[model samples]
Target: MEVSVNQDNFSILECFSSPTRIRIIELLNERPMNIRSLSEALDIKPPIVTRHIQMLEQAGIVASELIAGKRGQQKLCSLKLEQMVLNFRSQIHNKKPSVQKYDVMIPVGMYADYEVKPSCGLASEHSMLGMCDDPRYFADPVHRDARVVWFSSGFIEYRIPNYMLYNEQASSLEVSLEICSETPCSSSHLQPSDIVFSFNGIDVAVWTFPGKIGKGTAIFTPQWWHKDIQHGVMKHIRVNEQGTFIDGVLVSNMTIDALSLCADEEIVMRISSRSDAKRCGGVTLFGSGFGNYNQDIHCTITCK
Candidate 1:
Protein backbone atom coordinates (compact mmCIF):
# COMPACT_ATOMS: atom_id res chain seq x y z
CA MET A 1 0.00 0.00 0.00
CA GLU A 2 1.37 3.42 -0.97
CA VAL A 3 1.56 6.03 1.81
CA SER A 4 3.13 9.44 2.56
CA VAL A 5 5.89 9.86 5.13
CA ASN A 6 7.25 12.98 6.82
CA GLN A 7 11.00 12.29 7.39
CA ASP A 8 13.31 9.31 7.98
CA ASN A 9 10.48 7.20 6.59
CA PHE A 10 9.85 3.46 6.80
CA SER A 11 6.85 1.54 5.46
CA ILE A 12 4.91 -0.48 8.08
CA LEU A 13 1.35 0.86 7.82
CA GLU A 14 0.69 -1.75 5.19
CA CYS A 15 1.67 -4.48 7.62
CA PHE A 16 -0.59 -3.03 10.38
CA SER A 17 -3.84 -2.77 8.37
CA SER A 18 -4.64 -6.46 8.02
CA PRO A 19 -6.62 -7.65 11.06
CA THR A 20 -4.68 -10.87 11.31
CA ARG A 21 -1.37 -9.05 10.89
CA ILE A 22 -2.19 -6.53 13.63
CA ARG A 23 -3.13 -9.36 15.99
CA ILE A 24 0.16 -10.98 15.22
CA ILE A 25 2.04 -7.73 15.96
CA GLU A 26 0.24 -7.24 19.27
CA LEU A 27 0.87 -10.79 20.45
CA LEU A 28 4.52 -10.74 19.55
CA ASN A 29 4.95 -7.28 21.05
CA GLU A 30 4.45 -8.76 24.50
CA ARG A 31 6.63 -11.83 23.96
CA PRO A 32 7.49 -14.47 21.41
CA MET A 33 4.54 -16.80 20.94
CA ASN A 34 4.48 -20.07 19.03
CA ILE A 35 2.15 -20.40 16.05
CA ARG A 36 -0.12 -22.76 17.99
CA SER A 37 -0.72 -20.21 20.74
CA LEU A 38 -1.28 -17.43 18.20
CA SER A 39 -3.68 -19.60 16.20
CA GLU A 40 -5.80 -20.36 19.27
CA ALA A 41 -5.84 -16.72 20.39
CA LEU A 42 -6.81 -15.56 16.90
CA ASP A 43 -9.29 -18.38 16.50
CA ILE A 44 -8.10 -19.01 12.99
CA LYS A 45 -7.27 -22.37 11.50
CA PRO A 46 -3.56 -23.24 11.88
CA PRO A 47 -3.12 -23.35 8.10
CA ILE A 48 -4.66 -19.91 7.64
CA VAL A 49 -2.50 -18.52 10.41
CA THR A 50 0.55 -19.98 8.72
CA ARG A 51 -0.27 -18.21 5.49
CA HIS A 52 -0.58 -14.83 7.25
CA ILE A 53 2.57 -15.54 9.23
CA GLN A 54 4.51 -16.06 6.02
CA MET A 55 3.36 -12.71 4.69
CA LEU A 56 4.42 -11.03 7.92
CA GLU A 57 7.81 -12.73 7.76
CA GLN A 58 8.39 -11.47 4.23
CA ALA A 59 7.46 -7.98 5.34
CA GLY A 60 10.11 -8.12 8.09
CA ILE A 61 7.45 -7.69 10.77
CA VAL A 62 7.59 -11.20 12.20
CA ALA A 63 10.11 -13.99 12.53
CA SER A 64 9.64 -17.68 13.17
CA GLU A 65 11.81 -20.47 14.54
CA LEU A 66 11.67 -24.24 14.75
CA ILE A 67 11.72 -25.52 18.32
CA ALA A 68 11.98 -29.19 19.34
CA GLY A 69 8.57 -30.46 20.41
CA LYS A 70 6.77 -33.78 20.97
CA ARG A 71 4.52 -33.25 17.94
CA GLY A 72 7.39 -32.00 15.75
CA GLN A 73 9.24 -28.73 15.29
CA GLN A 74 7.14 -25.79 16.67
CA LYS A 75 7.44 -22.47 14.90
CA LEU A 76 7.71 -19.36 17.09
CA CYS A 77 6.96 -15.78 16.01
CA SER A 78 8.06 -12.37 17.31
CA LEU A 79 7.77 -8.66 16.42
CA LYS A 80 10.67 -6.65 14.92
CA LEU A 81 9.29 -3.18 14.66
CA GLU A 82 10.34 -1.63 17.97
CA GLN A 83 9.18 1.71 16.55
CA MET A 84 8.39 2.93 13.03
CA VAL A 85 8.91 6.44 11.64
CA LEU A 86 7.98 8.18 8.38
CA ASN A 87 10.57 10.85 7.56
CA PHE A 88 11.10 12.94 4.40
CA ARG A 89 13.65 15.63 3.71
CA SER A 90 14.17 18.25 1.01
CA GLN A 91 17.95 17.93 0.50
CA ILE A 92 21.45 16.89 1.67
CA HIS A 93 24.82 18.60 0.90
CA ASN A 94 26.98 21.38 2.33
CA LYS A 95 29.28 23.99 0.76
CA LYS A 96 30.51 25.78 3.90
CA PRO A 97 33.48 25.27 6.26
CA SER A 98 33.32 22.52 8.92
CA VAL A 99 33.88 22.50 12.70
CA GLN A 100 34.79 20.12 15.59
CA LYS A 101 32.80 17.25 17.10
CA TYR A 102 30.92 17.12 20.43
CA ASP A 103 28.20 14.83 21.87
CA VAL A 104 25.92 15.14 24.92
CA MET A 105 22.53 14.10 26.33
CA ILE A 106 20.26 16.88 27.60
CA PRO A 107 18.13 15.72 30.51
CA VAL A 108 14.38 16.48 30.65
CA GLY A 109 14.45 18.79 33.65
CA MET A 110 17.68 20.80 33.31
CA TYR A 111 16.36 23.73 31.34
CA ALA A 112 16.55 27.46 31.93
CA ASP A 113 12.90 27.23 33.09
CA TYR A 114 9.83 25.10 32.41
CA GLU A 115 6.15 24.69 33.41
CA VAL A 116 4.57 21.38 34.41
CA LYS A 117 1.39 20.22 36.15
CA PRO A 118 -0.13 16.96 37.33
CA SER A 119 -1.79 14.81 34.70
CA CYS A 120 -3.60 11.64 35.74
CA GLY A 121 -1.33 9.00 37.37
CA LEU A 122 1.58 11.39 38.03
CA ALA A 123 0.81 12.03 41.74
CA SER A 124 1.91 8.61 42.98
CA GLU A 125 5.15 8.65 40.98
CA HIS A 126 5.81 12.26 41.88
CA SER A 127 4.77 13.96 45.12
CA MET A 128 1.88 16.32 44.34
CA LEU A 129 0.77 19.30 46.39
CA GLY A 130 -2.50 20.24 44.68
CA MET A 131 -5.36 18.31 43.08
CA CYS A 132 -5.10 20.14 39.78
CA ASP A 133 -2.79 19.88 36.77
CA ASP A 134 -1.35 23.37 36.87
CA PRO A 135 1.90 25.30 36.23
CA ARG A 136 2.75 24.97 39.92
CA TYR A 137 4.54 21.72 39.20
CA PHE A 138 7.49 23.79 38.03
CA ALA A 139 7.45 25.97 41.15
CA ASP A 140 8.12 23.18 43.66
CA PRO A 141 11.41 24.03 45.36
CA VAL A 142 12.50 20.42 44.99
CA HIS A 143 12.30 18.79 41.52
CA ARG A 144 11.62 15.33 43.00
CA ASP A 145 8.35 16.77 44.34
CA ALA A 146 7.51 18.15 40.85
CA ARG A 147 4.94 16.40 38.69
CA VAL A 148 6.73 14.25 36.12
CA VAL A 149 4.01 14.90 33.52
CA TRP A 150 3.75 18.11 31.55
CA PHE A 151 2.60 19.60 28.20
CA SER A 152 3.66 22.80 26.49
CA SER A 153 2.72 25.23 23.73
CA GLY A 154 5.98 26.82 24.83
CA PHE A 155 9.51 25.59 24.11
CA ILE A 156 11.88 23.54 26.28
CA GLU A 157 15.20 25.18 25.44
CA TYR A 158 18.69 23.63 25.83
CA ARG A 159 21.69 25.90 25.87
CA ILE A 160 24.83 24.27 24.39
CA PRO A 161 28.01 25.56 25.96
CA ASN A 162 30.69 27.18 23.79
CA TYR A 163 33.64 24.92 24.66
CA MET A 164 32.55 22.20 22.18
CA LEU A 165 33.13 24.24 19.02
CA TYR A 166 36.55 24.21 17.29
CA ASN A 167 37.59 26.17 14.20
CA GLU A 168 37.69 24.64 10.66
CA GLN A 169 37.49 21.01 11.83
CA ALA A 170 34.90 18.59 10.46
CA SER A 171 32.26 17.92 13.10
CA SER A 172 28.49 17.43 13.55
CA LEU A 173 26.09 17.84 16.47
CA GLU A 174 23.41 15.28 17.45
CA VAL A 175 20.61 15.62 20.03
CA SER A 176 18.30 13.20 21.87
CA LEU A 177 15.10 13.83 23.88
CA GLU A 178 12.12 11.84 25.34
CA ILE A 179 8.82 13.30 24.24
CA CYS A 180 5.08 12.44 23.75
CA SER A 181 1.46 13.64 23.41
CA GLU A 182 0.17 16.30 25.80
CA THR A 183 -3.41 15.03 26.14
CA PRO A 184 -3.12 11.88 28.28
CA CYS A 185 -5.31 9.22 26.66
CA SER A 186 -5.52 5.59 25.64
CA SER A 187 -5.59 4.37 22.03
CA SER A 188 -3.95 7.64 20.93
CA HIS A 189 -6.39 8.91 18.23
CA LEU A 190 -5.29 12.50 17.85
CA GLN A 191 -4.61 13.88 14.37
CA PRO A 192 -1.16 14.56 12.92
CA SER A 193 0.49 17.66 14.39
CA ASP A 194 3.93 19.28 14.05
CA ILE A 195 6.72 19.46 16.66
CA VAL A 196 9.69 21.64 15.81
CA PHE A 197 13.33 21.25 16.89
CA SER A 198 15.43 24.32 16.37
CA PHE A 199 19.18 24.82 16.68
CA ASN A 200 20.60 28.29 17.11
CA GLY A 201 18.00 30.35 15.19
CA ILE A 202 17.47 27.94 12.29
CA ASP A 203 14.40 25.71 12.02
CA VAL A 204 16.35 22.41 12.10
CA ALA A 205 13.65 19.80 11.84
CA VAL A 206 9.89 19.17 12.06
CA TRP A 207 8.29 15.91 13.23
CA THR A 208 4.60 14.97 13.21
CA PHE A 209 3.12 12.94 16.07
CA PRO A 210 0.46 10.21 15.66
CA GLY A 211 -1.02 11.34 19.00
CA LYS A 212 -1.32 9.89 22.54
CA ILE A 213 1.49 8.45 24.67
CA GLY A 214 1.87 4.84 23.55
CA LYS A 215 1.94 5.33 19.77
CA GLY A 216 5.76 5.32 19.88
CA THR A 217 7.44 4.45 23.20
CA ALA A 218 8.01 6.02 26.65
CA ILE A 219 10.31 6.18 29.73
CA PHE A 220 9.86 6.32 33.53
CA THR A 221 6.12 5.67 33.12
CA PRO A 222 3.78 4.24 35.77
CA GLN A 223 2.29 0.76 35.33
CA TRP A 224 -1.23 2.22 35.44
CA TRP A 225 -0.76 3.74 31.95
CA HIS A 226 -2.20 1.63 29.16
CA LYS A 227 0.46 -0.07 27.06
CA ASP A 228 -1.07 0.46 23.60
CA ILE A 229 -0.96 4.27 23.69
CA GLN A 230 2.22 4.81 25.70
CA HIS A 231 4.70 4.61 22.80
CA GLY A 232 7.57 7.04 22.10
CA VAL A 233 10.87 6.93 20.09
CA MET A 234 14.28 8.49 19.73
CA LYS A 235 14.96 10.59 16.59
CA HIS A 236 18.66 10.78 15.56
CA ILE A 237 19.74 13.90 13.73
CA ARG A 238 23.10 14.94 12.26
CA VAL A 239 24.48 18.43 11.75
CA ASN A 240 27.51 17.47 9.67
CA GLU A 241 29.03 18.06 6.23
CA GLN A 242 25.86 16.49 4.81
CA GLY A 243 23.56 19.09 6.42
CA THR A 244 20.74 18.68 9.02
CA PHE A 245 19.00 15.34 9.53
CA ILE A 246 16.33 13.59 11.63
CA ASP A 247 17.94 10.22 11.03
CA GLY A 248 20.49 9.63 8.27
CA VAL A 249 18.18 11.40 5.79
CA LEU A 250 18.86 15.05 5.16
CA VAL A 251 16.46 17.74 6.31
CA SER A 252 17.65 20.10 3.56
CA ASN A 253 20.13 20.20 0.69
CA MET A 254 22.38 22.41 2.76
CA THR A 255 25.15 20.40 4.48
CA ILE A 256 26.27 20.79 8.11
CA ASP A 257 29.10 23.10 7.12
CA ALA A 258 26.64 25.55 5.63
CA LEU A 259 24.58 25.85 8.80
CA SER A 260 27.36 27.66 10.62
CA LEU A 261 27.73 28.03 14.39
CA CYS A 262 30.88 29.78 15.57
CA ALA A 263 33.10 28.23 18.24
CA ASP A 264 31.87 30.68 20.85
CA GLU A 265 28.22 30.57 19.76
CA GLU A 266 25.50 29.21 22.03
CA ILE A 267 23.29 26.46 20.57
CA VAL A 268 19.64 25.93 21.45
CA MET A 269 17.31 23.02 20.68
CA ARG A 270 13.81 24.47 21.00
CA ILE A 271 11.05 21.84 21.08
CA SER A 272 7.82 23.68 20.32
CA SER A 273 4.47 23.39 18.47
CA ARG A 274 3.54 24.24 14.91
CA SER A 275 1.25 27.13 13.99
CA ASP A 276 -1.43 24.59 13.00
CA ALA A 277 -0.77 22.61 16.18
CA LYS A 278 -3.88 20.66 17.20
CA ARG A 279 -2.93 17.99 19.75
CA CYS A 280 -0.69 18.19 22.79
CA GLY A 281 2.39 16.52 21.28
CA GLY A 282 4.30 18.25 24.04
CA VAL A 283 7.61 16.54 24.89
CA THR A 284 9.11 14.93 28.01
CA LEU A 285 12.71 16.18 28.36
CA PHE A 286 14.57 13.33 30.13
CA GLY A 287 17.94 13.93 31.73
CA SER A 288 19.15 12.90 35.26
CA GLY A 289 15.65 11.95 36.49
CA PHE A 290 15.07 9.76 33.45
CA GLY A 291 18.14 7.67 32.63
CA ASN A 292 19.22 7.54 28.99
CA TYR A 293 18.10 4.57 26.92
CA ASN A 294 21.07 5.25 24.58
CA GLN A 295 19.06 4.96 21.35
CA ASP A 296 15.73 6.47 22.47
CA ILE A 297 16.70 10.10 21.78
CA HIS A 298 20.30 11.35 21.45
CA CYS A 299 22.20 14.40 20.10
CA THR A 300 25.82 14.38 18.91
CA ILE A 301 28.55 16.10 16.89
CA THR A 302 31.38 14.07 15.34
CA CYS A 303 34.48 14.77 13.22
CA LYS A 304 37.76 13.17 12.12
Candidate 2:
Protein backbone atom coordinates (compact mmCIF):
# COMPACT_ATOMS: atom_id res chain seq x y z
CA MET A 1 0.00 0.00 0.00
CA GLU A 2 1.16 3.60 -0.77
CA VAL A 3 0.50 6.34 1.73
CA SER A 4 1.33 9.96 2.60
CA VAL A 5 1.31 11.83 5.91
CA ASN A 6 -2.15 13.33 5.51
CA GLN A 7 -5.27 13.55 7.62
CA ASP A 8 -7.14 11.03 5.50
CA ASN A 9 -4.43 8.43 6.12
CA PHE A 10 -4.20 9.08 9.86
CA SER A 11 -6.12 5.88 10.60
CA ILE A 12 -3.42 3.89 8.84
CA LEU A 13 -0.66 5.91 10.47
CA GLU A 14 -2.22 5.33 13.86
CA CYS A 15 -1.71 1.58 13.42
CA PHE A 16 1.92 2.04 14.46
CA SER A 17 1.15 4.00 17.60
CA SER A 18 0.08 1.09 19.77
CA PRO A 19 2.56 -1.63 20.70
CA THR A 20 -0.26 -4.19 20.96
CA ARG A 21 -1.42 -3.45 17.43
CA ILE A 22 2.16 -3.65 16.16
CA ARG A 23 2.54 -7.04 17.78
CA ILE A 24 -0.71 -8.20 16.18
CA ILE A 25 0.63 -7.17 12.79
CA GLU A 26 3.88 -9.01 13.46
CA LEU A 27 2.03 -12.17 14.48
CA LEU A 28 -0.29 -12.07 11.46
CA ASN A 29 2.75 -11.66 9.25
CA GLU A 30 3.99 -15.00 10.47
CA ARG A 31 0.63 -16.64 9.71
CA PRO A 32 -3.14 -16.19 9.87
CA MET A 33 -4.44 -16.75 13.40
CA ASN A 34 -7.67 -16.68 15.38
CA ILE A 35 -8.47 -14.30 18.23
CA ARG A 36 -8.12 -17.10 20.74
CA SER A 37 -4.72 -18.03 19.39
CA LEU A 38 -3.53 -14.41 19.45
CA SER A 39 -4.89 -13.90 23.00
CA GLU A 40 -3.11 -16.98 24.25
CA ALA A 41 0.12 -15.98 22.56
CA LEU A 42 0.02 -12.39 23.78
CA ASP A 43 -1.34 -13.21 27.23
CA ILE A 44 -4.29 -10.96 26.62
CA LYS A 45 -8.04 -11.47 26.73
CA PRO A 46 -10.00 -12.50 23.62
CA PRO A 47 -12.05 -9.27 23.71
CA ILE A 48 -8.86 -7.19 23.81
CA VAL A 49 -7.42 -9.05 20.86
CA THR A 50 -10.60 -8.35 18.90
CA ARG A 51 -10.34 -4.65 19.68
CA HIS A 52 -6.79 -4.47 18.36
CA ILE A 53 -7.73 -6.36 15.19
CA GLN A 54 -10.64 -4.01 14.66
CA MET A 55 -8.26 -1.08 14.61
CA LEU A 56 -5.98 -2.80 12.11
CA GLU A 57 -8.90 -3.75 9.90
CA GLN A 58 -10.17 -0.19 9.84
CA ALA A 59 -6.83 0.93 8.49
CA GLY A 60 -6.86 -1.70 5.73
CA ILE A 61 -3.84 -3.25 7.38
CA VAL A 62 -5.57 -6.55 8.14
CA ALA A 63 -8.58 -8.69 7.10
CA SER A 64 -10.54 -11.49 8.71
CA GLU A 65 -13.25 -14.07 7.99
CA LEU A 66 -15.50 -16.13 10.24
CA ILE A 67 -15.16 -19.90 10.25
CA ALA A 68 -16.22 -22.85 12.36
CA GLY A 69 -14.17 -23.43 15.50
CA LYS A 70 -14.29 -25.95 18.38
CA ARG A 71 -17.16 -24.21 20.18
CA GLY A 72 -18.40 -21.56 17.79
CA GLN A 73 -17.31 -19.44 14.80
CA GLN A 74 -13.81 -17.99 14.79
CA LYS A 75 -12.38 -14.96 13.06
CA LEU A 76 -9.32 -15.99 11.05
CA CYS A 77 -7.23 -12.89 10.61
CA SER A 78 -4.46 -12.13 8.09
CA LEU A 79 -2.30 -9.22 7.03
CA LYS A 80 -3.94 -7.28 4.23
CA LEU A 81 -0.71 -5.78 2.92
CA GLU A 82 2.47 -7.57 1.97
CA GLN A 83 4.32 -4.27 2.42
CA MET A 84 3.78 -0.52 2.31
CA VAL A 85 5.58 2.34 0.56
CA LEU A 86 5.55 5.71 2.30
CA ASN A 87 6.07 8.91 0.26
CA PHE A 88 6.91 12.20 1.94
CA ARG A 89 5.93 14.12 -1.17
CA SER A 90 5.05 17.62 -0.07
CA GLN A 91 6.45 18.76 -3.44
CA ILE A 92 3.69 16.92 -5.34
CA HIS A 93 1.30 19.81 -4.75
CA ASN A 94 3.73 22.19 -6.43
CA LYS A 95 4.16 20.25 -9.69
CA LYS A 96 2.45 21.15 -12.97
CA PRO A 97 -0.46 19.04 -14.16
CA SER A 98 -0.44 16.70 -17.17
CA VAL A 99 -0.68 18.12 -20.68
CA GLN A 100 -2.50 15.72 -23.00
CA LYS A 101 -3.48 12.05 -22.99
CA TYR A 102 -5.22 9.19 -24.85
CA ASP A 103 -6.75 5.93 -23.70
CA VAL A 104 -6.88 2.36 -25.08
CA MET A 105 -9.53 -0.12 -23.99
CA ILE A 106 -8.42 -3.67 -24.64
CA PRO A 107 -10.42 -6.74 -23.70
CA VAL A 108 -8.73 -9.24 -21.38
CA GLY A 109 -8.81 -12.01 -23.99
CA MET A 110 -7.54 -10.10 -27.02
CA TYR A 111 -4.00 -11.29 -26.47
CA ALA A 112 -1.64 -11.23 -29.47
CA ASP A 113 0.51 -13.97 -27.93
CA TYR A 114 0.54 -16.36 -24.99
CA GLU A 115 2.29 -19.40 -23.46
CA VAL A 116 0.15 -20.88 -20.69
CA LYS A 117 0.22 -24.02 -18.58
CA PRO A 118 -2.59 -26.11 -17.04
CA SER A 119 -4.94 -24.93 -14.28
CA CYS A 120 -5.69 -22.25 -16.90
CA GLY A 121 -8.84 -21.20 -18.69
CA LEU A 122 -10.97 -18.35 -20.11
CA ALA A 123 -14.66 -17.60 -19.98
CA SER A 124 -17.25 -15.17 -21.17
CA GLU A 125 -20.13 -13.85 -19.10
CA HIS A 126 -22.53 -16.30 -20.73
CA SER A 127 -20.41 -19.45 -20.97
CA MET A 128 -16.97 -21.02 -20.81
CA LEU A 129 -14.78 -20.45 -23.86
CA GLY A 130 -13.38 -23.97 -24.03
CA MET A 131 -12.47 -26.87 -21.77
CA CYS A 132 -10.71 -25.88 -18.56
CA ASP A 133 -6.93 -26.35 -18.25
CA ASP A 134 -6.48 -26.81 -22.04
CA PRO A 135 -4.08 -24.46 -23.86
CA ARG A 136 -5.49 -25.08 -27.35
CA TYR A 137 -8.85 -23.58 -26.37
CA PHE A 138 -7.13 -20.25 -25.88
CA ALA A 139 -7.01 -19.97 -29.70
CA ASP A 140 -10.68 -20.55 -30.23
CA PRO A 141 -12.28 -17.94 -32.43
CA VAL A 142 -14.61 -17.09 -29.57
CA HIS A 143 -11.68 -16.45 -27.19
CA ARG A 144 -11.83 -12.74 -28.04
CA ASP A 145 -15.08 -12.49 -26.11
CA ALA A 146 -13.59 -13.72 -22.84
CA ARG A 147 -14.35 -11.53 -19.82
CA VAL A 148 -12.25 -13.39 -17.28
CA VAL A 149 -8.98 -15.30 -17.80
CA TRP A 150 -6.79 -17.23 -15.39
CA PHE A 151 -3.72 -19.47 -15.33
CA SER A 152 -1.65 -21.37 -12.80
CA SER A 153 1.64 -20.34 -14.43
CA GLY A 154 2.69 -18.52 -17.62
CA PHE A 155 2.32 -15.12 -19.25
CA ILE A 156 -0.38 -13.41 -21.33
CA GLU A 157 0.46 -10.52 -23.64
CA TYR A 158 -1.82 -7.79 -24.97
CA ARG A 159 -0.84 -5.32 -27.68
CA ILE A 160 -2.14 -1.92 -26.59
CA PRO A 161 -2.67 0.53 -29.44
CA ASN A 162 -0.41 3.58 -29.36
CA TYR A 163 -2.50 6.63 -30.13
CA MET A 164 0.27 9.23 -29.67
CA LEU A 165 1.52 11.01 -32.79
CA TYR A 166 5.05 10.48 -34.14
CA ASN A 167 6.38 13.83 -32.88
CA GLU A 168 4.69 13.58 -29.50
CA GLN A 169 6.93 12.86 -26.53
CA ALA A 170 5.22 10.30 -24.31
CA SER A 171 5.27 11.25 -20.63
CA SER A 172 3.66 8.34 -18.85
CA LEU A 173 1.64 5.14 -19.29
CA GLU A 174 -0.93 3.88 -16.80
CA VAL A 175 -2.68 0.50 -16.80
CA SER A 176 -5.56 -0.31 -14.47
CA LEU A 177 -7.61 -3.48 -14.09
CA GLU A 178 -9.12 -5.82 -11.52
CA ILE A 179 -7.12 -8.87 -10.56
CA CYS A 180 -6.39 -11.44 -7.80
CA SER A 181 -4.33 -14.52 -7.07
CA GLU A 182 -5.65 -17.93 -8.21
CA THR A 183 -5.12 -20.76 -5.77
CA PRO A 184 -6.15 -24.40 -6.20
CA CYS A 185 -7.37 -24.66 -2.65
CA SER A 186 -9.23 -21.33 -2.78
CA SER A 187 -7.07 -20.20 0.09
CA SER A 188 -6.83 -16.40 0.20
CA HIS A 189 -4.58 -15.58 3.13
CA LEU A 190 -1.46 -17.70 2.91
CA GLN A 191 -0.97 -18.02 -0.85
CA PRO A 192 0.70 -15.00 -2.42
CA SER A 193 1.30 -14.53 -6.14
CA ASP A 194 4.24 -12.50 -7.40
CA ILE A 195 2.83 -10.82 -10.53
CA VAL A 196 5.31 -9.29 -12.96
CA PHE A 197 4.38 -6.49 -15.37
CA SER A 198 6.26 -5.70 -18.57
CA PHE A 199 5.98 -3.13 -21.33
CA ASN A 200 7.65 -3.94 -24.66
CA GLY A 201 9.21 -6.96 -22.94
CA ILE A 202 11.05 -4.73 -20.43
CA ASP A 203 9.91 -5.81 -16.97
CA VAL A 204 8.61 -2.64 -15.34
CA ALA A 205 7.42 -3.79 -11.92
CA VAL A 206 6.38 -6.77 -9.82
CA TRP A 207 3.82 -6.92 -7.01
CA THR A 208 3.04 -9.71 -4.60
CA PHE A 209 -0.76 -9.89 -4.25
CA PRO A 210 -1.63 -11.02 -0.73
CA GLY A 211 -4.04 -13.65 -2.06
CA LYS A 212 -7.81 -13.14 -2.46
CA ILE A 213 -9.18 -10.21 -0.48
CA GLY A 214 -11.70 -12.31 1.48
CA LYS A 215 -14.40 -14.95 1.10
CA GLY A 216 -16.65 -12.40 -0.55
CA THR A 217 -17.30 -12.56 -4.28
CA ALA A 218 -16.82 -9.77 -6.77
CA ILE A 219 -19.92 -7.61 -6.96
CA PHE A 220 -20.05 -7.86 -10.74
CA THR A 221 -19.37 -11.55 -11.07
CA PRO A 222 -22.03 -13.48 -12.94
CA GLN A 223 -24.10 -15.91 -10.93
CA TRP A 224 -23.25 -18.76 -13.33
CA TRP A 225 -19.55 -18.38 -12.67
CA HIS A 226 -18.50 -20.44 -9.69
CA LYS A 227 -14.96 -20.58 -8.43
CA ASP A 228 -13.30 -20.84 -5.05
CA ILE A 229 -11.40 -17.67 -5.87
CA GLN A 230 -13.91 -14.81 -5.93
CA HIS A 231 -12.82 -11.17 -5.70
CA GLY A 232 -9.77 -9.07 -6.67
CA VAL A 233 -8.33 -5.66 -5.92
CA MET A 234 -8.14 -3.03 -8.64
CA LYS A 235 -4.47 -2.28 -9.34
CA HIS A 236 -3.10 0.86 -11.01
CA ILE A 237 0.35 0.65 -12.59
CA ARG A 238 1.99 3.79 -13.94
CA VAL A 239 5.29 4.36 -15.73
CA ASN A 240 6.40 7.98 -15.81
CA GLU A 241 9.47 10.24 -16.00
CA GLN A 242 10.67 9.20 -12.57
CA GLY A 243 10.09 5.44 -12.69
CA THR A 244 7.59 2.61 -12.78
CA PHE A 245 5.09 2.64 -9.94
CA ILE A 246 2.45 0.16 -8.77
CA ASP A 247 -0.35 1.70 -6.75
CA GLY A 248 1.87 4.84 -6.52
CA VAL A 249 4.84 2.96 -5.09
CA LEU A 250 8.10 3.28 -7.05
CA VAL A 251 9.08 -0.28 -7.94
CA SER A 252 11.77 0.19 -10.59
CA ASN A 253 14.01 2.63 -12.49
CA MET A 254 12.25 1.89 -15.81
CA THR A 255 10.94 5.25 -16.95
CA ILE A 256 8.55 6.15 -19.75
CA ASP A 257 11.42 7.42 -21.92
CA ALA A 258 13.07 4.01 -21.68
CA LEU A 259 10.08 2.43 -23.43
CA SER A 260 10.53 4.49 -26.67
CA LEU A 261 6.73 4.56 -26.94
CA CYS A 262 6.72 6.25 -30.36
CA ALA A 263 9.24 3.83 -31.86
CA ASP A 264 6.90 0.93 -31.15
CA GLU A 265 3.69 1.08 -33.16
CA GLU A 266 2.02 -0.77 -30.30
CA ILE A 267 2.98 -1.44 -26.70
CA VAL A 268 3.22 -5.10 -25.74
CA MET A 269 1.98 -5.42 -22.17
CA ARG A 270 2.59 -8.72 -20.44
CA ILE A 271 1.44 -10.08 -17.04
CA SER A 272 2.97 -13.17 -15.64
CA SER A 273 3.85 -15.25 -12.58
CA ARG A 274 7.10 -17.02 -13.36
CA SER A 275 7.59 -20.37 -11.67
CA ASP A 276 10.87 -19.07 -10.31
CA ALA A 277 9.26 -16.13 -8.53
CA LYS A 278 9.37 -16.33 -4.76
CA ARG A 279 5.57 -16.53 -4.60
CA CYS A 280 4.41 -18.83 -7.37
CA GLY A 281 0.65 -18.66 -6.78
CA GLY A 282 -1.16 -18.15 -10.11
CA VAL A 283 -2.90 -15.05 -11.57
CA THR A 284 -6.49 -14.20 -12.55
CA LEU A 285 -7.58 -11.26 -14.72
CA PHE A 286 -11.10 -9.84 -14.32
CA GLY A 287 -12.75 -8.03 -17.19
CA SER A 288 -16.04 -6.18 -17.87
CA GLY A 289 -18.26 -8.93 -16.56
CA PHE A 290 -16.15 -10.84 -14.08
CA GLY A 291 -14.36 -8.82 -11.39
CA ASN A 292 -14.96 -6.19 -8.76
CA TYR A 293 -14.56 -3.44 -11.36
CA ASN A 294 -16.62 -4.09 -14.48
CA GLN A 295 -13.99 -3.01 -17.00
CA ASP A 296 -11.41 -4.40 -19.36
CA ILE A 297 -7.71 -3.53 -19.30
CA HIS A 298 -7.65 0.28 -19.27
CA CYS A 299 -4.44 1.86 -20.59
CA THR A 300 -3.84 5.60 -20.74
CA ILE A 301 -0.90 7.47 -22.23
CA THR A 302 0.08 11.07 -21.54
CA CYS A 303 2.27 13.09 -23.90
CA LYS A 304 4.39 16.17 -23.37
Query: Against the hidden true structure, what lDDT does model 1 obtain?
Result: 0.54
**Tens digit of per-residue lDDT, candidate 2, span 1-304:** 4588777688889989999999998997665688999999999999999999999999899888876677998888877664676877744567744477888889998998888877888889998888888889988888899998888789999999888877788988999887887742334453688999999989999999986463465555788876766657778899999999887789999999888788449999999989898998888888887755566998989887
lDDT of 1 by residue, 197-218 (tens): 7777677777776553344443
**What TM-score goes with each of the models?**
0.53, 0.67
RMSD of each: 10.3, 8.4
lDDT of each: 0.54, 0.82
Q: On a 0 to 100 scale, what is the lDDT of residue 165 in model 2?
A: 78
Find the candidate with the highest lDDT and give its number.
2
* Candidate 2: pairs in clash: none
